[model samples]
Target: MIKKLLVGIVIITALALAGVYYAIEQAKSYLQTPLALNQAELVTITPGTSFNRAIGLLVAQGWLSETPYLRLLPKLYPELTNVKAGTYQLVAPLTAYDALAQFTQGKEHQFTITLVEGSRFSEWRQQLAQAPHLTHQLTELSEAEIAAKLGVDREKLEGLFLAETYHYTAGTTDVALLQRAQRNLERVLKKHWAQRDAALPLRSEYDALTLASIIEKETAIASERSRVASVFINRLNLGMRLQTDPTVIYGMGEAYDGNIRKKDLRTATPYNTYMINGLPPTPIAMVGEAAIAAALSPEQSDYLYFVASGRGDHVFSKTLAEHNRAVRAYLKVLRNQ
Candidate 1:
């Protein structure tokens, strides 16, 4: 009777081991199974979310199936439970194991917002308002308030942020992104200012930025920037009015009807280069690094005037007579067109 009891105990132990092996095999299979995703989807994991809760959310969304084996995954691979909090992108044909790996490795989905050169600060704000997956903290704040949040001392926010593509995760704040851009602008401006030509007519780095914004608006051609800078620099040296039309348009603000009239040029405003003696009180637009560099170290030339060639380029001139001739040629081209 005692021998029979020992045999029964051995049999029970064997069955328990078999059950454990089967459970482990099922968990491994579940981990390797592909998710039920028809297309790419976004999954947001908020801060302090637990691993089990995240798995439950996936199962509820039908991306994953309800199974006891999913609970065994963390026990089998301890690292699978260390999921980071952020938005993740799950693509089809990806196995459940790989998706979990993405979470564990903190491989969050990235989004980009590009701040374009020659665009106004107001336009940038509009873009930020429309950006997806970004937290809008500055929607109700005025420009001055936003600047204060960014730790900027100036009241004017124009030309303070750099024009570049900024990358962010799902929960990134608009003010945070702007802060990065502002820091980048400060770093770049400081470096360039230290390297600028000593003989430049610019009184400070701010003056260079102001000039760069003008150059950014004047031309879109990459090769014409330095030459455009040269023309403006020459005008400044000769104490002549810049006579730039972009500044006039900026000064007109909402009153500008896509045309600059004789009276508009005669109107006195701080931004009107035709009426002002030097650079505008502030930058009129966001500027690129190339424009800034050109402003700090303009090309050495006798050019003082430029007009559109009607061929997506400019005709630069050293004398008023030559500039008038080029202007007539530009008008003729426009008339023919």
Candidate 2:
């Protein structure tokens, strides 16, 4: 009787082990082949969802080979408890076990959005609205609203962020992300500001940056930046009007006809450089680090006047006569007759 009982116990243990071996073997066979796979797709996991919902989503999306195996996944593999939430690239035609492992390990989706240098707040607003991954609309947000929402000061946001492509997931806060951009700019600017040449007459880093914004608006040429910086520094020393064309353009607001007529320069506004002296009350546009550095450590020169010589470059001059000559050359290019 004892022998018979032992044999029965042995049979039951062998049967359980056989079932375990069969399940594992079946799982492996299904996971290895690429059998009529569907195209990979983006899956968004919203906050406060469950593993059951994820399995349902996979099955509904035709990604999983077996739906019943979903509940059994955590039991078969203990790592499923560590799955994270966010956007993921779900690859189709995957075995249930393999899909579980993939999701359990957590793959986050990412995208890049650029905040170009010199973009106006309005332009940035539009860009934020259009971004696929970013979740905030900062362009239309009032300065006060942005400050309240992000817990930042409204008046101190000028030139806060770098103009470059930033990487992020979808649903990133526009205001918070922009704040990060602002922090990035501040960190970089401070680092560079410390290394600036000590001989400059600038009162502060912000003051140098203010002048740099003006110089940046003056031209587009990479080589012309320092020369523009030179002319502005000279003018600041002599206490002369900036007399910049871009400032006139900025003052026009929405009414600007894109043509800077002779009379437009005469229009009186706070942004009009022909009317105002020294730096404008605020930056005309978002300036880059190069412009800030150039402002702080300007090229040492006696040049007090500069005129665009056409071809997207400008000619520098220390005298009115030299400037007038450049003005004629640029006028000739514009006339082309």
Candidate 3:
């Protein structure tokens, strides 16, 4: 009878071992199983959200199935429980293991907003207001108030933010993003200003930025930037009015109807470079690094004038006669078109 009892105990131990192995296999399968999602979805986990609660929320949303094996996941791999809080993008054909891995690794969904070169600060504000999932803190604030918040002068805020694609997770404030851009601009501008040509005639970094903005508005052609800069620099040296039409359009504000009248050039405004003898009071628009670099280090040339060639580029000229001929040619092209 004692021998029989020993045999029964051995059998019971064997069955218990088998049950443990089966449970582990089931949990592993559950981890590898794809989530029940037909489309991509965003899941936001607020701060202090527990791993279990996150799983439960997914289950409730029908993206995940409730199973006993899910409880075993954390026990089998302890690191799976260390989920970070942020918005995550879950796509189809992804397994439960993959989703959990993303959460634990803090792979939050990233959104991007591009601030274009030569665009106005007011236009940038409109873009930020329309960006999805971004926290809108500057919606009601005036431009002056926003500048004050950023510790910048209200009048000098137009061209301060760098033009670049900024990426951030959800809940990022517009002001926070602007601050990052502004900081990047400051660092870049400082570095470029220090390396600038001494004969540039720029009084300060702000002067370079103002000049850069004009260059930015003048041309979108990559090769034309430094040449355009040279024209402006030559004109500045000769004490010639910039006479740039973009400044006139900027001065016209809402009254500009896709055309600049001769009278507009004569009308005096702070931004009217035609009437203003020097650089405008502030930059008319945002400028990229390329424009800024050109402003600080212009191509050496005697060019004093430029006009659209009607071929998506400018015909640069060193004399008024050449410039007038080019302008007449441009008008002929316009008339023919």
Cα lDDT, all candidates: 0.90, 0.72, 0.90
Candidate 2 per-residue lDDT, tens place, 1-337, comes to 9999999999999999998787776645554534234677677766755667766676576655453444444466576556567887656565554555666666676778888777666677678788886776676667667767767655645454566778887778887678778787787678767987776656676667667677767776667777788888778778888888877887898979879988888888888888888777766776777777777667788998888777767788889998898899899999994
Residues 276-324, candidate 1, lDDT per residue (tens digit)?
A: 8999999999988888888887899999999999999999998989999
Q: What is the lDDT of residue 278 in candidate 1?
A: 90
Write down the TM-score of every candidate.
Answer: 0.94, 0.83, 0.96
Query: What order do candidates take by lDDT, descending?
Result: 3, 1, 2
Model 3 shows how many backbone clashes?
Answer: 0
Residue 49 C-alpha lDDT in model 2: 54
Against the true structure, whose TM-score is highest?
A: 3
In model 2, the runs with Cα more than 4 Å from the true position are: 1-19, 31-40, 48-52, 90-102, 137-140, 148-158
lDDT tens per residue, model 3, 155-224? 4588998998999999999999999999989988998999998888789999999999999999999899
Clashing pairs in 2: 125-139, 160-182
Task: Give the count of colliding residue pairs in each prediction.
Answer: 0, 2, 0
Score candidate 1 by lDDT: 0.90
Which runs in model 3 stand beyond 4 Å of their true positions? none
